[model samples]
Each structure stands twice: as structure tokens, then as C-alpha cells.
Target: MTYCVGMVLEKGLVLMSDTRTNSGVDNISVFRKMFTWQVPGERIITLMTAGNLATTQAVISQLEERTKEPDERDNILLKSPTMFQVATEIGRLMRGIISERQDANGVKGRGRFTASIIVAGQIKGMEPRLFMVYPEGNFIEASLDTPFFQIGETKYGRPIILRGYDRQMSLEDAAKLLMVSFDSTLKANLSVGLPLDLQVIERDTYEAGHQHRIGHDDSYFAAISDGWGDALKNAFHSLPDYSFYRPDD
Candidate 1:
């Protein structure tokens, strides 16, 4: 399991994903789940995946292979005229791969090889867009009512995002918010581990504005983790005390 989040803000998009993939307690390993493709000044696309490692890796490998062969018309990441089309192409690819694997394995492969993806980026003339593609090949774009998406080990980090997200927030602030959320998830779940991948795309830049990997020794992340825990404790203590005794009743 892993945790990946993509947020849409006025300044641009912020994405982060954990690197842990575990089959069992002793079989744990790290694999990056975030992949990005950019056409310099033309467009930029980022995909963060979660679910079956094999399935996600297969999809990413195919995309990269296609990109390398310019003659391949299926290199939709670079050929798509619009961001929506790019997402549609990805959805189709994801669905095809999942279905093919499932059909080949019959009963044993049902949900075992399923995966989901969060695709975010900007196309030359369009506004930055974000989409969460489901395992079935369908997807929904982020809007005012839903400006972000989370997949895998989501329960632990979701509340923090819900309480703090703002559409107009700066990319820097967005990254900080994600760190706190990831930290909370890290503390509560063993499946999602360290060495997180982060990327920021400023609106209209058509390229990644910032990118970094947060390992266990990263001081900023360490501080965020520690500070958030203390802040939560202080906030809890500041709340008014509740009593079981009801004298008025």
C-alpha cells in the first residue's frame, strides 16, 4: 500500500506520494509511484498511482516506451491536444491493462491487480487540471467542490486535507499542508513509509517548478511531523473540558 495526493491551487498543482510497497511484514520494499512527462513549453503532466504495484508499473512502462518512439501515434501524453484528452487516453490505457490481466488470470486476478491514478498538469492554452482516474477507466476532474484527490492509505491523511485545503493557497503552503497530512498518515499506518516524492507545477509554466524527495533524514519533513503533533496536542488541550455530570438535568 502507499499514499498519493494531488491538489489543485490557484498558484498551480502540488503532488506527493509515498514510496513504500509491502507484500508482508518482511517483504516490504520501496518503489516510486509518481511519474511525470513534460514537453517543455508545450505541456506538463504528472501521474501518481496507487494499488497493485505490477499493474501501475506496467502502465508507466508502456507510456515511457511510447514516448521514446516518436513515430508511435499512441504516445498520447505528448500528442493529446488537450489535458482532457490526455486524461481520457490514460484512462483507456489503465482500464485495458487491468482488464487484460484480470481476464487472463480468471477468478484469482479479480481485484488483485487493480490500480488507480491521479493525473494532474497543464496544457499550453488551458487552465491547470486535475483528475482521479478509477480502476474502471472512468475519471472525475477536480472542481471547486472537490479540489484534490487521495488514493491508498487515505483514511489517516484525509481529515487534515479537508480541514486545511484552500483553492487559493500558494504552492509552498500547499506542500507544507501535504507534509503534515503525510506525517499524520505515516504515524498511524505502517504501510505508508518514508522517502516521499514531491512536485510542484506553477500555473502556465508548462514544466515542473519544484521537485524533491523527502527521505527519513530530511529536516523540513522531520520538523513538520514533530510540530504538527505538538500543535494537535495543544489544540486538544485548549478545547473546553466536557463533564459527564449533568447538574441542570
Candidate 2:
């Protein structure tokens, strides 16, 4: 399992994903779940993937291959005129790969493979956009009402976002909020272990303003984890307790 989140903010986009995959308790491994492509000053794109690892890898590989081939069909890097189209192409690719794999293996319902992707970037002459692509090749754009999207092992980390998210928050605050969310998931879930990959894209720049791989020993993340826990405990204790409780009420 994995955890991935893509947030659309007034500043730009913030993406975070864990790097763990597990077949069983004894068989666990790490594989990067985030992929990025950039044309420097022209365009920058990032994708966070979750669900069937094989399907996601194949989709990414096919897209990469197309980008390398001059005569190949329009791939994620070339075919899409806007961030919207890029998301559509990625969704289509994901569905196509899953269908082909199922047919070849004859696994039917038992081996159904699926994946979800968060696509965010900007093309020259257009504004930055973020999209969440479903397994069926359909997607929705992030708007003011829904400014973020998450996939894979998401339930553990969603509440922080729901409670703290604000469209006008500074990128620094947004990144910190996401780290706290990740901290919550890491503490509660064994499947979502890290070295987390994070990228922050600033508006109109068409480049990643900050990108880093946070490992188990990362000091800043450690501080955030400890600080948040202490703060939460303090707040819980400070909340007014039930004063009129009755044993048989």
C-alpha cells in the first residue's frame, strides 16, 4: 500500500507520497511512487500514483518510452495541450494497461488491477492546474470548493487537511500542514512507511520551487512529529470535560 496527496493552493501545487510496498509482513519493499517531468521554464508536471504497483509502473514506463521516441503517439509529455488533457491521457493509459493485463492473465475479477493518479502542472500560456484521475480514465479538476485530492491509504491523513486547509495559506504553512498529515498516517499505519517525496511548485514559475526526499532520520520532520503530538495532547487535556456525567444516564 501507499499514500499520496496532491494539493492545489493559491500559490501552486504541493505533492507528497510515501515509498513503501508490501506483499506480506515478511515481504515488504520500497519503491518511489512519485514521477516528474519538466521542461524547465516552459512546463512542469508531477504525478503521484497509488494502487497496483505493477499497473502504475507499466503506465509510467509506457509514458516515458513515448517521450523518448520521436514517432510514437502523443504521450503524457507531448500529447496534452493543457494540464487537463495530460490528465486524460494518463487516465486512458492506466485503464488500457489494466485491461490488457487482465486479458492476458485471464484473472478476471480476482486480478483486477487499478490505479489513481494526481496530475498537476502548467503549460506555457496557461495557468497552473491540478487534477485527480480515476481508474476509468475520467478525472475532475480541483476548484475552490475542493482544493485537493488524495489516493492510497488516505483516510488516515485526510482529517488534518479537511480541518486546516485554506486556499489562501502560504506555501510554507501548506507544506507544514501536509507534513503533519503525513506524520499522522505514519504513526498509525504500518503499510505507509517513508522516505517521503515532496515537491512544491510556485505559481507562474513552471518549476519546482522546493523538492526533497525526507528520510526516517530527517530532523525537521522529527520535530514536526513530536511538536504536533505534544500540542494535540495539550489541547485535548484543555478541552472542557463532562461535568454532569451520571453513572446510569
Candidate 3:
């Protein structure tokens, strides 16, 4: 399992995904779950995936292969005229791969090889958009009512985002909020570990804005992790004391 989030802010978009996958206690390992495709000044796309490792990897590989051999087939990521079309194309590809493999592997493998992905990016002249593609190939776009999407090991980190998210906040604040969500997840779950991969894309700029990997020794992440814990403890202590007995007693 893993934890990944893609948030759409008024200023831009922020995406983060941890790099861990586990089969069992002794078989735990790390694998990057974020992938990006960009065309410098024309377009920028980020895809974060979670679920069966093999299926996700296969979809990513096929997408990458499209970029390299554009003449042979429709390089939808490069040629899609709108962000919606891009999401549609990605959804189609995801479904195709999942279904194809399921047929070959048989009915018993139905849910075993399933995968889901979060697609975030913008085409030139388009607003930055975010979508969460389901394992079945259908998807839903992010909106003001729900401006972010998370997949895999989500319960631990979701509450933080719900209480803190603001569509008007700057990209920096959005990233910081996600870091806290990630820290909360890391503390509670072993299936999701880091170094985490993060990327930001500013509105109207058809280029990758900021990118980084947060490893164990990353100082800023270390501070965020420690600071959050201290803050929580202080908040708990600051709460008014409650008593079961009457104050006079």
C-alpha cells in the first residue's frame, strides 16, 4: 500500500506520493509511485498511482513509450487539445491495461491486480485540473467542494486535509499542509514510507514549477514531523480539564 494526494488550488496544483509497497512484514520494499510527463512550455502532467504494483508499472511504461514513438500512434498526452481529453485518454489506457491483464490472469485475479491513479496537470490555455481515475477506468474531477483526492492508506491522513485545506492558499501552504498529512500517515502506518515525491505546477505556466524528494534526512520534513507532534501535544494539554465529579466535591 501507499499514500498519494493531488490537490488543486486557486494558484496551481500540488501532488505528493510516498515510495513504499509491501507484500508482507518481511517482504516490504520501496518503489516510487509518482510519474510525470511534460513538454516544457506546452504542457505538464503528473500522475500518482496506488494499488497492484505490476499493473501501475505497466500503465506507466506504455504511457512513456507513447511519448518516445509519437509517429506510430496517438500520443494523447502530447496531442490532447484539452485537460479533460487528457484525463479521458488516461482513463481509457488504465482501463484497457487492467481489463486486458484480468482476462489473461482469470476471474480469481479480479481485484488482486487492480490499480487507481490521480492525474493532475494543465494544457496550454486551460485551467489546471485534477482527476482521480478509478480502477474500473471511470473518474471524477476535483472541485471546490472537494478540491483534493487521495488513494491508498488514506484514512490516517484524510482528517488533516479536511480541516486545514483552503482553495485560496498559496502553493507553498498547500504543500506544507500535505506534508503534515503525510507525516500523520507515516506515524500511523508502516505500509506507507518515504522518501516522498512532490511536484507543483503554477497556473498558466505549462511547465513543472517545483519538484523534490523528501528522504529520511530531509531537514525541512524532519522539522515538520517533529513540530506537528509537539503542536498536537500542546493542543491536547491546553484543552480545559473535564471532571466526572462536581467541582465542590
Give the Cα lDDT of each candidate. Answer: 0.90, 0.87, 0.89
lDDT of 2 by residue, 165-229 (tens): 99889888888999999999999999999899999998888777799999989999999998998
Arranged by TM-score with the best first, the candidates are 1, 3, 2
Backbone clash numbers for all candidates listed: 0, 0, 0
> What lDDT would candidate 1 get against the real structure?
0.90
| Candidate 2, run of 10 with poorest lDDT | 66-75
Q: For model 1, what is the error of residue 170's alpha carbon versus the real structure, in angstroms, after optimal superposition?
A: 1.4
Instruction: Supply candidate 1's per-residue lDDT for 229.
Output: 75
Error of 1 at 178 (Å): 0.4
Window of ten residues with lowest summed lDDT in model 3: 66-75
After superposition, the stretches of candidate 2 with alpha carbons farther than 4 Å from their true spots are 66-75, 109-111, 245-249
Model 1: weakest 10-residue lDDT segment is 66-75
**Which sections of candidate 1 miss by over 4 Å?**
66-74, 108-110, 246-249
**Which model is ahead, 1 or 2, in terms of TM-score?**
1
Q: In candidate 3, what are the lDDT values of residues 1-249, reduced to their tens digit?
A: 899999999999999999999998779888989888789888998889999898898888776564466667655577778878877877788888888888887844447788999999988877899999887878999998999999999999999899999999999999999999999999999889999999999998989999999999999999999999899999888998888897698
lDDT of 2: 0.87
lDDT of 1 by residue, 9-125 (tens): 999999999999999878999898998889889899999999998888888877656446666535568788888887787788888889988888883534778899999999999
List ranges where model 3 is wrong by over 4 Å. Answer: 66-74, 108-110, 246-249
